[model samples]
Target chain A: MRTRTLYMGMIAALIVVVGLVGCSKKPPPGEIIPPPEVTPSEMPQTERVPGDETAPPGSAAEDAALQIEDVFYEFDKYALTARARDTLTRDADVLLANPGMRLLIEGHCDERGTREYNLALADRRARASRDFLVAYGIDASRLETISYGEERPFVLGSTESAWSKNRRAHFVVRQ
Target chain B: MKPIVHRFSIREPEQARAHGLRAGPFTVALLFWAGVLTVALLFCADAAAPEIDLHGTVVKRTLYRVPIVVEDFAIEASPGERNDPLFFSGGERPEDLLVQDLRFSDAFQVVRRRQGSFDPAGEPPRDIDGALVEQPIQARVVGRMEWDDERLRLKAELIDQGTGNRILDREVAINREGELARPDRWAIHRLSDEITRYLTGTPGCAATRIAFLRESRSGKELFLVDWDGYEEQAVTGLGTILVSPAWHPSGERIAFTSYHRGAPVLVALDLESRRLATLSTAPTPAAAVYSPNGKRVAFSTTAEGDAELYVARADGSHARRLTFHPDIDTAPCWSPSGERLVFTSDRCGRPQLFLIDADGSNLQQLTFSGEWNDSPDWSPAGSRIVHVCQIGGRFELALIDVQGFGWRRLTVGGGCENPRWAPDGRHVVFALTQAGVRNLWILDADSGNLRQLTASPDHSYNPGWSRPARERIRASG
Candidate 1:
């Protein structure tokens, strides 16, 4: 049993090394230099990328130079899915690498719920994502979230497809 | 919705002569107009959009269209020649008494248009139509008015917006001296009110209601009382921490938060049955409310971290967050049409109000004063929003127009919190804790009349008025 545990640990360490090696080979366009002896929790505010106070109406990656995936949640639940976890991972990486970058995680609900509850639930979802990012190492100070509740939907119809697209966490770039 | 009878006004005395009617005929016309007013007042019912009951029985969900009345400047006259003193005519004719009356009525929930500074009543001159208002609705009023002689004439029509059919077109006379010293030409005020009755089938809600919270024992209990401080009933018997009580659109149930059970949780209780159910439990107490369509509930919670907004079902399922701010983000209220929400946040420093589309895409800052401004409750007509604005030493209720202009104070008291609008949107109820005494108070939307509610001997707080139920049926517990 000790040998098997050791083997699993070795594999995990190898995966981390390979990932770091890949990062070094293809360092992102702008070299994000992490502060010496810096911890991940202190990364967001320290990396301080020039963020926009108001992001323009341009498509997803406009103001903060951060790319967020379409966060999807299971029906009747506000928990972030594996895909959402992976998407938020990108946000965590961006914050960890570029300390100046901040995120506004806006939570939304499908048109199926009540307005005030949806607002609270959307807020919870946004906080859920914010907590995940923080747990993974992003600075808490540089992040914010707001709940639009069910007031805002990505789709217009009442169909399941529209609801699926609506029950989501959207990333907004805040300067 | 046309007036039961229309009365023509006698102007220049010659016009009265033109009909070959003697001066004595004026009284007969006046009596007829009074009869019309009396009838209109008796039959006009609260005007709500025809319900389609699309989601009824299952949840028994029934949504009414936002009542919209389209009234322009005109002298509404009951055809024929005899002139009556009750026929209304004021500044710029129809723009005066009749138009203003339409805007003031309870049943129709009149939505008027802006005809520039030309409007006689000094109404904000902003269009009630256009992008400023949203929501699919059916109730509306359209009419016109004009002035002549020492008398003013009003020709007005109330029409259903969804269907361009004339609800009512009545001519009422306004006697200048008898009306001017009074309100909107007193003679015509009564007559136009009757016209409104014809349009709505229910008398006005002007002299009616207000629901607010009365704080006692340091903000412990929440009570509901009549607009005039009578029959006080505690909406919350938690005997613990409770605040922020709001009426559902239907006014049948109240949505609020209570901390009696340790953590703050959302709950809705049927006003008649007292059957209460817990929706969700949070680390701290927050505000919750039903959508305009009565489908969803928007609330605030701190379950994850700092306070933030969330949404869920009436039965408390499918919770989703709307904000991710680490700062205080609380109090969510839906616009009357349920397409948008206005809430309070400390994100921009002090507590200020903000609006977001129902889809969570468009975010806009609404209030500028850095002081604490929270608890936004939109008007039933979607024309205004009432909120609590706290200054250095003065806490007062404030009103902002739908266009976000014309921020005005509705109260100047020191401890007023959570301003809730009457169904007619012309009256507001709120909590006031002053001089170590806590009580609920009501304010008339126009005159700002003060009506204090000391309903109980206990330190009552947080009023959640059930909107006056239309049928007053025996609901379930």
Candidate 2:
């Protein structure tokens, strides 16, 4: 039932995102900038993003939109669990539906690991989630990954419960 | 033996005179009234009056005598306690409280009273015993215990055996029924510390813990450890890039940064609950931290594409931009008082020490000699700031007093990067490598005696000392 709700949100996010195919703007090489004005109706009718071939056009209208319920990890390990797989599948569907959708899989860990190592571990974890989704047929280009390490914890207690919740990978919608 | 119950204060003499208390003869009038009063009343009045010194002694080591006389030491029991014969398990009572403390200090050669009655005035002999080569002296630790409302109070004292004089005294009045009451172990440790101070003029380890960061190829994690580097436990295990773990006003929580996702975001991890909370990830990731009580943190960020200094609460609130027109300001440490922040900035062509207020005012450059001085860890007593300054391609831990003077080297030119203070402010912990083996080492905050803490397994990179949480704040407040 929860996945169903997430699917609904994914569909809504896709409809709006697919309308932004290759139309998804990016800065020129070597500069960091945002997408400029592009009409939803003017989006290319190709199977992929016009300028960005990595995007799958009209996939947002398919059964590709997935839902993910924050997947958490153990103390310092970045490998996802069986339960985390379920969430990743949902997120993959969302990425698959909107070829124009670029995702930033933010990896996170609890406050039990070192800062630098956790950053790398979180990156691995985020990549783990992204790799699984891509293997499930989602385009890698549309999916971006980064790690915040144990620096950004969702919960703020030094208890097992808090640590469990903090060691996780959070999904964020990209422009 | 009694303490000379004489009260002297800045306002004592004037107040005593105003109250018509003259120096003629306080004992004479008191004796005259005591003759008409009962013994209990007489004792009560005398308890508050100037106490008479039946005996007093102070221990001092001599080139000739290791057996320095110590005063105010005695042993006593209240009906039944750890020392009762009924609890004796071996040659002597294993649970004897004072005896255990006496042995732990390793300062004295304790001699227990013989089974015979104590000869209060009988001298043992003119010649010292040959077997007693160390120190030949007797100590008596007396504890007066009372129970009230289910709580126990123990007032302790120590003295020289021969003179029966008071040398040192302390009290542990515990109300064990409440949540705030400390554990018996804590009280015992405090008691042991008082004894050490009484003998050595300086206190020994009793109330102390170590904080360190475990480093690995994957990520660096923060850990809290005992002084012996035992009981080591990870505090922040967010397997991401972690840097500069600082004890919050509450030692139970720590403020640090973990690059879990993208940018270096500041986080606070509660040591007890193992919970992690992101304090700030918006506007820009928190660079450094001073807790909400005003402990300043040193953060690395690029507000202008060059990493700069910004102070924020350990909880990620009440932040203020501390440096402007900066080259690259980072690593801000809060003085124990939280009034000033010591940090590193490249404002002078390279990283050097800088001082500023919590609100970003009172900006002043601190280091003039070092080419690069980074990682400023403010002393727990607000006495000095410990940091690393580059010296001929290598870095050393240097401590600059609060006045930016008395700059002294803590670690000789070596691979020391970070310098953190122990709770008692006597030692510091840093990371160094030999033969390409990186490890954490502890150093005397005064003498700079480098002692390796963690050798193998995963190299200890950045070590953060854990100051007691409540004391961290009270020390600053």
Model 2 chain B — which ten-residue stretch has the worst lDDT?
Answer: B54-63
Tens-digit lDDT track of model 2 for A72-167: 777645567877887777766666556655666777876542343344456657777877887999877877665665656788665689988877
- For residues B235-321, what per-residue lDDT tens digits would candidate 1 score against the true structure? 444444454566666666776665444334677666555666677775544677788777888876777676777777776688788
Best candidate per lDDT, number?
A: 1
Question: What lDDT score is found at residue A26 in candidate 1?
Answer: 39
* Cα lDDT for residue B213, candidate 2: 62
lDDT of 1 by residue, A22-57 (tens): 444332556432212313332213233223455556
Return the lDDT, model 1, position B180.
23
- Which portions of model 2 miss their true places by more than 4 Å? A1-175, B1-189, B192-205, B216-218, B282-287, B291-300, B468-477
Compute the lDDT of residue B220 as modeled in candidate 2: 66
